[model samples]
Every structure is written in structure tokens, then in C-alpha cells.
Target: MLIGTVGNEPYQRVSSDNGPYEGAMLGAAIGAGGAGAGIFGARMHYKGIDNRAKRHISAIESREPVIQRKINKVNEQAENPRMSFIQKAKSKIADSGINQINNLRTAQLDSLNSKNEQLRNVVDSMQHTNPNVANEADLSRRSHYAQSYADINSHYDDVIQGSRFSKMKQQVDQSMEHKQARIEKNRDVKVSRLNKELEKLSDGRHKWGEDGVKLMKQKHPYAHVKGIGRSAAAIGAGALIGGGAGMILGGLTDEVNKHVKQ
Candidate 1:
């Protein structure tokens, strides 16, 4: 009877504890596994995000040189050259009183030349119609007109010769100056935009990197701690139950020996 009780007692002890022990171990394993996985995944994800941020920062930095190259190209294209002699003279002679008088005289001379034939025909008709007035008037009018035309033509020739190259050079130089100014203005705006974009990328990269570091600090160690705590608790409880079972088995063995001895 003692041997049978001992055998049945050991069976009942195992049957009673088996489910709870297995349950505790399973729960601990799942908890620890989940925590470990969470820690690992979080770390990996943080690394991925960090790498992407770094790449973004690098890409932004790379564009700085490209922008600089564009600026350099524009500067090269728009470089100022020294003024030519004609350009200098044009700058000196512009809008002066002498130049205005010369322009007006040249215009009058051109108009007089256009109407010369008609004026000569009217003078000849008048000489036929009124001989006395024509005889006196014709000599003075022709003499005065010819002398004035000659003097004005000579002055216009001088003015044109002095100003022709100057005018053309001034036009060409002004065009270059205007184009350079436009390019410089556009370059300034482009550089400003690039700088803003680069700053934005830098700021974004820094923020993301800092956040990743903080998240790693928060998640990785915490996950490990949780996993270790749960696992340790399960292991300790299993040990305690096993020790109690050993004590019970020892007592049952002693009783069985006593019954055999009797």
C-alpha cells in the first residue's frame, strides 16, 4: 500500500504541476522572444532611418558644388572687359549742346537737299514772270543756299565721322553690360534658393538623426530588460516548483522504506 501510494502521489504531483509550469514557460518564452525581436527590429529600423538621413544630407551637400559651378559659369560669361577708345569717347560726348546743334544742322541740310530741285524750278519761273525781282533775288538766294549747304554738309560729315564708331561701340558695350547685370541678378536668386534648400536638408538630417538616437536609447535596452525580467521570473518559479517536488518525492521514498522494513 505504501509503494502504491508513493507511485500515485508522484503521478498526481506531476499531473497537477505540468500544465501550469508549461504555461508559465510558454508565456515567458513568448514574452522574451517578442521583446528580443522588438529590440532588434527597432535597432535595425533606426539604423535604416539614420542611413537614409545621412544620404539625404550627403546629396544636399553635393548640390552645393553644382550650384557653385553654375555661379562660376555665369560669372565667367558675364565678366567685364575694359572700355574701348570709341566707348570712352561716346561717354564723353553724350547729350552735349554742341552735339545737339550739330544734329539739328544735319537735319536741316538733309531737308534742304531734298527740296533743292523744286526751289530752283520756282526761282526760274519767277525770273520769267518778273524779270527785275528775279535778276536781283536769284544771285543772292543761290549764293546763300549753296554756301549754307556746303558749311552744314561739312559739319555733318565731321560729326558723323567722330560719332560713328563711338555709337556702335556704345551699343555693343551697353548690351554686354545689360546682359551681365541680368545674369548676376539671376545668379544671386539661384544661390539664395540653393542655400535655403541646403539648410533645410541639413536641419532635417540633424533632427532625424537625433530622434533615431533617442528612440534607440528608449527602446533597445528597455526591451532587453523586459525580456530578461520575464524569463528570470519564469525560471525562478520553475526551480521553486522542482525543489518542492523533490522534497515530496524524498518523503514518499522514506515512507515506502519504512513499510518495507515492517
Candidate 2:
């Protein structure tokens, strides 16, 4: 009985020692697996943050050029007088659906205004500097200049479409053309009659040739009126025709080449 009990005691102790060893090995394996998973998760998180920062930097670099270009354009505009003039004129003469015409008008007005201001300022400065220059003769000359300025301004007032001023100017021009034509036609008829009368007066004058025959009765001023009347009539008719031709050309030029495109 004593030998059997000692044998049983060694077997029980062996079983107890085997349980603790197996448990320790399993616990070590679980700890190693958890540590590896945490390391992988931390690496993934840091890499995602790095990629996001790179994309943000790239986006900022792309937009920087557009912003810089606008700033440069503004700086150029601030320094340029011609550009400022164009902008001012454009504000005055803009319209829908006609950018080219508006730009042309802006340029034209800019040039015209700049020239006018320069001339005006020079005159003002001269008068201010030399009081002696403002004598009677000088004042008369200045008055004449002012009259010339008024005449030029009267010729080309800004007559926008759909305005009463435009309608009035058009009507006045038409009336002037009609009246001038009538005067020209009447003068032509009068000249033709005078030429016929001269031929009758110098019918038998041997001293006067065909061309000079109109001057036959030079001494008889009261007795014959042919030469003088005929010559005056011819000159008047020539003047009328020349003026009419000039008027036609001027009208055509005005229509084809407008001062203001808009």
C-alpha cells in the first residue's frame, strides 16, 4: 500500500507541471500577434496623413499662377495712361454684342480727349504766365479761337440713337442738302440764259473772236449787259457745281469713316 501511494504522488505532480507550461506558451503567442497588428495600423495612419499633405501642397501650387497673373495685370493698368484712358472711354461707350466697335470708339475718344486737353491746358497756362499776353489783340485772337472751338463742337455733338438730339441733327442735315441743291439748280439755269444772251450781243463784232466776242461792248457798259452777266453766271455755276461735288464726297466720307465706332 505504501509503494502504490508514492507512485500516484509523482504522476499527479507531473500532470500539474505540464498544464502551466502549455498556458505560458499560448499567452506569449497572443501577445506577439497583438503587437504586430498595432504596428501595422500605426504605419497606415501616418502614411495616409503624409499623402493628404502632399495633395494639398500640389493644389496650392497650381492656383498660385492664376492669382499672380491677375495681380500683374492690375499693376500694369495702374501705371499706363493709355490703358486708363481706354478704360474710361469704354465705360462711356459700351454696348451689348459689339466688343470690337466699343473698343474702337474707346480708342478714338481717348485720342481726341487727350489732344483736346493738351491744347486747352497749354492755352490756359500761357495766359496765366504772361499777363501782358492778354492784351486787346491777344484777347481778340483768343475769342476767335473760342469761336473756332464752338464751330467744331457744333459740328460733332454726340447724338446717340433713339435720342431726340440725333433726330434733330439728321433733320437739319437733310434740310440743308435740299436747300443747297435747289439753289444750285436755279443758278445753273440762270447761267445758261446769260450765255445765250452774250452770243446775240456780239453777233457782228469782228474785233472779238468767238471766245473774246463776249467782250465786244466793253465800252458800252449801259447799252449791253451780256459780257458781265454771262461771265458772272458762268463763275457762279462753276462754284455751285464744285461745292455740290465737295458736299457729296464729304457726306460719303462721313458715313464710311465714323469718328466714334460705337
Candidate 3:
């Protein structure tokens, strides 16, 4: 029969066949076994949580240097000039060439207009039997000349719009912008991830409290003392209960045997 409780909870039982001393010993053994199982389970639970926290911390430490190096490299690239002096000079030369070509096209158009005017004057001074033919020929020449003038001007406008230096400047600016954006994105992402990991591991709790092993000890204090204390208390209680129940049972059994004999 179960004889006693630890903390108001029954934990030990004794067999009916056992003598008083034997019953007491069996009850005590059962109590101790139960306490031991409880202690083991508690220890494992605490250890699992602590180990998970430690693994997370270790992972963060190992990855920090690699992440920092990548951050530095990106920062350096963002800060440095994209174009060298040679490249700048080349862009300038290309821009100058474009300007020269635009000027040449303007001069050629002016020359064509002047030559056309002179030919028109010569045609007007000559006598023509068909005046309408002459008029139609002059109109056709004027149309062709206007078309040529418009085409040259359009080409010049295109060249000016696509200036090499301007294009290069825009490209360099865009490249720098992209690099800076990348640096910021990388830093934010890594820092946010690390912070979240630390938060989870620390259970949203930490402080700049101690250093080295002391820090670790503070964070995860030993449970040995508490466990030992509980085990000792349990054993002591079991032994006390077992001894009292054993004496009572022994007296009752003797009384029952004597009654049976009579």
C-alpha cells in the first residue's frame, strides 16, 4: 500500500507480503527512485534550452568577421571614384568630336542653301517656252533642298543629345548610387538578422554584466545545488514516512496472526 506523500503527492508504495522492516526499505527505495527521475528530467529540460542558446551565440560570433569584411569591401567601392583621369579625358575628347561634327553639318547646310539660291537666279534669267515646267522644276528643287536641310539639322540634334561626357557622367552617378544602396542593404540585413538571433537566444534579455567565464556562469547558473537539496529532502521525507508506516504495519500483522491462531 502507498503509505505517505511528498509535498502532498503520493510517491511510494510497499508490497503486502513484505515484513515491517522490508516494507520501510522498499518504500524508501521507491521514493528515492521517483525523486531521481524528477531531478534527471528537470536537468535535461534546462540543459536543452541552455545548449540551444549557446549554439545560436556561437553561430553569430563565427559569422561576424566574414560579414564585416564584406561590408568594408562594399563601403570602399562606394567611396572610390568610378572613372580614372584617362577615362575622363577620353569622354571629353569624344564630346569635342561630336561638337565639331555638329558645326560641320551646319556649315554644309549653309553652303548648300547658298548654291541653290545662285542656281535659281540663273534659271530665272533664261527664257523658257514652257513657263509652267520651269515653275514646277523650281518648286521640286526647293522641296528637295528643304528636305536635305531638315535631315542635317535632325542629325545634329541627335549628336548633341548623345554627348559622350554627359552619358559617362550619368553612368558613373548611377553606378555610385547603386553601390551605396547595396552597402546600406547589406549592412541593414546582416545587422537586423544578428540582432533578431541574439534577441531570440537571450530571450529578449541581456546586459553588459560580467566578463569571460563569470559572464557565462551568471547567464546560466548551476542547478546542482538546488537539485541536490531537493534529492536530499525527498530521501529524508521518504525514510521518515517509511519507518513510521513499517512499525504500524508490523503491529497490525502480528495482531491479525494471533487472532487467526485463537
Model 3 C-alpha lDDT versus the unseen true structure = 0.60
Off by over 4 Å in 3: 1-24, 34-64, 77-165, 168-172, 175-179, 194-234, 238-262
When sorted by lDDT, best at the front, the candidate numbers are 1, 3, 2
Residues 60-80 of candidate 2: C-alpha lDDT, one tens digit per residue: 455556555654554454343
Structural similarity to truth (TM-score) of each candidate:
0.35, 0.22, 0.35
**Model 2: CA > 4 A from native:** 1-24, 36-145, 158-262
| Candidate 1 segments exceeding 4 Å error | 1-40, 47-61, 74-161, 208-227, 230-262
* Per-prediction CA RMSD (Å): 17.1, 56.0, 14.6
Deviation of model 3 at 203, angstroms: 10
Looking at model 1, which ten-residue stretch has the lowest summed lDDT? Answer: 15-24
In the range 1-262, model 1's lDDT, one tens digit per residue, is 5556556543334433453344334444445555456555655765576576677667767776786686666566556544557656665565353467577886898887767766677778997689888766777678878987998878765775577544654575686687678867876787677678667766765654667556655664444444556656644555555555544544555655567779
The lDDT per prediction is 0.62, 0.45, 0.60
Writing each residue's lDDT as its tens digit, candidate 3 over 190-212 gives: 66666565555444234222233
Query: Candidate 2 or 3, higher TM-score?
Result: 3
TM-score rank, highest first? 1, 3, 2
> What is the TM-score of candidate 3?
0.35
